[model samples]
Target: MQVPDVMTAIEISTPGGPDVLVPGKRPVPQPGPGELLVKVAAAGVNRPDVLQRRGAYPPPPGASDLPGLEVAGEVVAAGQGATHLIGTNVCALVAGGGYAEYAIAPAGTSLPVPEGLSMAEAAALPETLFTVWINLFERGFATEGEWALIHGGTSGIGTMAISLCKLFGVKAVVTCGGDDKCAAALKLGAAAAINYKTRDFVNEVRQLTGGAGVNVVLDMVGGDYIARNLAVLADDGRHVSIATQRGVTAEVSFLDIMRRRLTLTGSTLRPRTLAFKTLVAEELRATVWPFVESGQLRPVMDRTFPLREASAAHARMEGGDHVGKIVLTV
Candidate 1:
């Protein structure tokens, strides 16, 4: 198929707010060697996209300046070395450029859309699922019957983490802002949902775990939550940070970490090497995709907007009222 000359995309001319996300036409990108040019059907709205739009998170070297990070689309054209994925329906975790009608993806990062999921739903899967899978399971060493705590339980990453915990039979405690969010977390298989506004999360987690504390913590809220997260960690627990919406710097006790023998680590997917991302994508296909295909796991969608309305999607995410992933249909 012949690729088009121009494509519709949401662009950020200046960084400030969601209003900066303006839809415009841009030259369509071509696939390089080992890449596939995808006709994007839908794209996910992620916190990283919001950060990029605000000029807080810039794309890495040789990546698109566009804000989007995940896309579900059909392979329209494949570059050299990517012939096997031509004409496939796929959802991929991208470094950037998903807010456009066509985006180029590394062939290895693309995965077949799981059975019974819509394109929009698939678009929502890659970023959150990949983040949760890598952090909670791979990095944190979360295992069956282990106790885990996830902060921001109503967010996209939180919801995905909770479901994975349940599927693997790991006990999970989640922290959210309200009773409704808490209830939603529990419905998604969280063993307990603590409303951070009304209760002390560290205290609640301690009580729920019979005073032994949790074995792992998936924390997106940094700063003030850091001290508390450490306080609630079980001996040899792993604390993985994925975001720092509250602030990155925190003054905490190293003695506490030393006493508990805790493991503290964090990762951002966009800056990772293509080889590393390919490995993560392959791991997801082998260990997690089957569960999605079999209905053992599902994408929790909060809302969707048209491709031109990317600003509205970001606004909704900033509002912090959403319970799951938000999407933008291209």
Candidate 2:
């Protein structure tokens, strides 16, 4: 097949706001060994992408300077070691380069899209779902019947966490900003939704758990939430931090941690070795993909914009009013 000479992309020339994301043309990237050249149909816009646009989190090392982290599309070409994935409709968790007409994806990180999902929905899954699964289940050891607290309850990660918890019979309590967001979380199988603006989530979580606190807490909000998170943990509870939207620095009580026997941990999807991501992909394919295929687990998309309108997509994500994932249609 003849590949196009150039492809349209959303480029951030300098760090700032959505205005920084300007549409531009770039040569189509070729797949290297163990890679697949994907014709991107849709790409998810994540908070990290926004941070990257602001120059706070640049792509690590050899990863694309382009913003997108997850994409869904058809495989148009494959490198020498990626022959088996050619022509597959795949959704991949990419290191970068997804905010374009075409991007190269590592073969091992690409998975066949669930039978009935659209490219947009598939694009929305990889980053948030991968983050939630790795932190909550892989690191936190969340199991059936255990209570889990997910901060940012109405977010893409939070919604996916709630759905997976529901599918596995685990109880989930989520924290969001408003009543509507709380209601949305509840509808998505959060056993209880706490409006962080109106209520103290730490106290509400304790009360909801009958003063026992939760077995695990997935926190994206850092800073002040840190001290309170430690206070709300059950004995032996796992607290995992994936992002620090508020701030990273905080003063917390070490005594509380010691007394509760808590385990505090966190991870970023990027920067990990390819072997680790391949393992995560394999685990998701074996354990989580089945539920997605069965429609028991679904991507909750709040909005979408055309690839040319990437600025608007970023703005919507920053607005914080969205209930779930945001996507850029290509």
Candidate 3:
């Protein structure tokens, strides 16, 4: 592959709305030790990208200033000890710069783009997969035959949760904003989908679980939902917070948590240590890659836009009308 000196990337020209995402030229980054330089075919648009655009989430120290978290492409170059990956198709979880024509990815975090998956679908996997796996399964401890309540049923994270739950035999009950989104979630393998705009998700989940309540809750909408989430958790249930879309802080009853033996926890993936992310990549390769290769696991795509139309992509995401993952194709 002929590597370029300069590449087009979507940059946050200023901290504001989606219109702030502007296409700009940047020097193509070089791969450091244990890194691969990928010719980016597609990059997944995520909530963090939008936050970064609005100045709410900034790139970690030494990371690229561009806004993309996952990308799928071919490895065009590699640093020492990772030369074997050159010329291979892969989708990788990146710290930043995925919105560019070229992006550097950690060699350990890149996974093979299997024959059955398209570049866009592969691009959509890493962020949501790593997030749901870490929070819902590893931290929440959702297991076979257990019931889980997930907010944002039709969003990227919600759909991935539903798919993983179905594959692992966990029953997923999700909350969506509209009837159409709820229907979409049900069709995507959720045990039940609640239209939160019209119905009380707490009562719906309780009723759906036959009054025993859910064994776990994967929450993106915090604030009042935190207390309501606790209301619907079964004894010894786990509540894992992945985002605070509604608000950050909430009042919770310590007595209620103690009485039910409930657990509350959360994490952000971007600032984590490289070694920890590498370990997660290895675990996903061992456990989840099989399903992906077999064509059983795939991202539910909402739409795609040209790389230069990244502002439009951000607008679509913030509008909250997209049902699944959105991608920017190079």
Candidate 4:
């Protein structure tokens, strides 16, 4: 296939609300060595994209200014060493530039789209899958037979964690904003789900664990949740933060951490080195892809928008009523 000279993309017009995201045209990005040029069918709308539009999270230096984290498409061309990927359909975790018709993906960060998934569903996989595996399974060590407490149970990451727990043999508990979301989380395979609006998450977790606490905590709500999150962990429990939806600054107690031997860790994907993303891709292909193919691990899609209607998609995401992943279809 001949790669196009120009492509449609979403650009942040200003540092403001959802209205800032505007459809624009730009030259299609070329894949460099060890990369693939994808003809995007769809892109996943993520919280990071929202942050970037608000000018809270800038693209790491050298990355495109476009706002999107994951995409699903067909490889139209490839760089010298990545010719093997040409003509393949794939889903990729990109640093940026995903909200476009044509995008470049480092070969290592792209994977074959799971069999029997729609383009929108495949587009929803990369960001949440990568984030969940790294935080819940790797860093937090929420392994088989252990217990994991996840915040934002209706979110993309939360739904992934909850659904995978059954397949992985981990007991998962979660916090959601409403009764409907709590029910949704449970239906997706959570052992338990708490409505944060009507109940206290810390108390529910404590009760669910018989006061022993969870083995790991996957939290995005930082600030005030920190102390409570620590309090709800088992001895030596791992607490991993991926985002700070509430606030960042907090007052932590050394005594609490020292007494329980707790570990608090967090990570952001975009700024990491190419080698790190490549390694993550390797790990996912080995450990998670099978689940994806077997129908055990599946994407939870909330809604989709035409690629040009990206601003409306941003509004939907910021509205916070949608559950699971939102996508942009080209």
Candidate 5:
């Protein structure tokens, strides 16, 4: 394959809204040591991209200034110690630089695009999958036969959480904004879905779990929900915060935490070291890749936009009506 000297990438012209994402020309980056240069076929659109576009989450130092966090494509070149991966299809969790025709990826954080998975689906997996796996299962200690309370049941992370929970035998009870979204969640194997707009989720969860409460809460919404989330936890339950979409600060009662032996934790993946992400990639390849290869697990794809229309893709994600992952196809 003839790799181009220059390629098109979506750059944040200014921090503002979707319109701030503009296509621009840049030199095609060569992979560094232990890295692969991928010809991007598709890139996943994530909420963090929105936050970055809005000037909230800046890329970590020494990372690309581009917005995308995940991409799936063919490896066209490789740096020393990573030459074996050249010519293979892969999906990678990148810190940045995914929204482009050519992007560099660390070989360690890249996973083979397994059989039966489309590029778009592969692109969608890394961010949400790594997030849910680390926070919900590893950090929160969710196990088989346990119950998990997940918010934003229709979002990429929520939907991935539901699928993983279902596959691992954890009953997932999710909250959505509307009846239609709730129905979608249930149809996607959620044990139960609560319409938070119409009902109090705390009460509904209590009823659904027969007053035992959930074993873990995978929360993306922060603020007042933190207190409410803790209230609905079973004895020794865990609360893992991944995002603070509502707000960051919250007032919680330490007495309640002490009484229940509850645990609260959170993580942000972007700033984590490449070694950590590489380890996560290896874990997923061993544990979760089988499901992906067998077609038993797949991302819920909502839509795809052309590479030039990155702004429109961001708009669709922000509109809040899409039920699943959005992709930008090159």
Candidate 6:
């Protein structure tokens, strides 16, 4: 296939709201060493994209200025180590540039789209899967038979975490905003779904665990929740955070951490070196791809929009009404 010289893309015209996103023309990015030039079919919208558009998070050095993190497409061209992937359809975790007709992705971070999945569904897999695997599983060492308390259980990553925990025999308890979201989480195999809008999660978690507390707490809401998260952990439990949606700063008692033998950690994907991403990609491909291929793991896609309507997609995402991922078709 002949690749395009230029492509249509959504650009941040100004750092502000969803309306700030506008269509523009740009040269189609070519594959660099260890990269693939993908003819993007669909792209997943994530909360970080919203943060980037609001100027809260900037693209890392050398990453595309565009604000998309994951894309599923056919590899039309390859560079260096990526040559083997030419002509294959795959989903990738990209640093940026996914919201375009053509996008570049590092070969290591790309994986074949699971059989029987559409581009939009595959597009939804990479970001949330990578986030959950790295933060909730690897860093937290989420283990079988233990309980994990997941925040935002109806969100993309939350849904994946719940399913994965169930698949691997780790029980999951989750917090969502409403009854419907709570029901959705429970349907997805969460052991318990707490509607934080109606109940105090700390008390509910304690009640659900019979006072033993959860073995791991996957947190996205930081600040005030950090203290409470630590409070609800079992002895030697892990507290892994992937985002700080509530706020960043928190006052925690060191004595509590030491006495409980708790671990607190977090990570952001884009700024990491390609080598770090490569390690994560290898692990996911080996450990998680089987579950994906067997249909036990799948994207919980909520909605989609045409590429030109990127702003509207963002509006829907920020509205927080959707239960799962929103994708952009290119």
Predicted structure with the largest lDDT when compared to the true one: 5
Single out the weakest 10-residue window by summed lDDT for candidate 4: 291-300
lDDT of 4 by residue, 1-330 (tens): 877798888998899998988889899988889999999999999999999998999999988889998999999999989999899999999999999999888899999986788899999999999889888888888889999999999998888888778888999999998999989988889999999988998898999899999999998999899989998999999999999988998788989899989999989878988899899899999988998888777888899999999999989988889899999999
Ten residues in sequence with the least summed lDDT for candidate 5: 109-118
- Residue 330 lDDT in model 5? 95
Candidate 3 — number of clashing residue pairs? 0
Cα lDDT of all candidates, in order?
Answer: 0.92, 0.92, 0.95, 0.91, 0.95, 0.92
What TM-score quantifies how close candidate 5 is to the native fold? 0.99
Task: Provide the TM-score for each candidate, comma-separated.
Answer: 0.98, 0.98, 0.99, 0.98, 0.99, 0.98
Candidate 6 differs from the real structure by a C-alpha RMSD in angstroms, to one decimal, of 0.9
Total clashing pairs for each candidate? 0, 0, 0, 0, 0, 0
On residues 1-330, what C-alpha lDDT tens digit does candidate 3 reach at each position?
789899999989999998888899999999988999999999999999999999999999989989999999999999998999999999999999999999999998899999979999999999999999999999999999999999999999999999999999999999999999999999999999998889998888888888999999999989989999999999999999999998999999999999999999999999998899999999999999999999999999999999999999999999999999999999
Candidate 1 stretches with Cα past 4 Å from truth are: none
**Shift of residue 293 alpha carbon in model 4, Å:** 1.4
Cα lDDT for residue 189, model 4?
Answer: 90
Q: What stretches of model 3 exceed 4 Å from their correct place?
A: none
Clashing pairs in 2: none
Tell me the deviation in Å of residue 330 in model 6: 1.3
Which 10-residue window of candidate 2 scores lowest in summed lDDT? 252-261
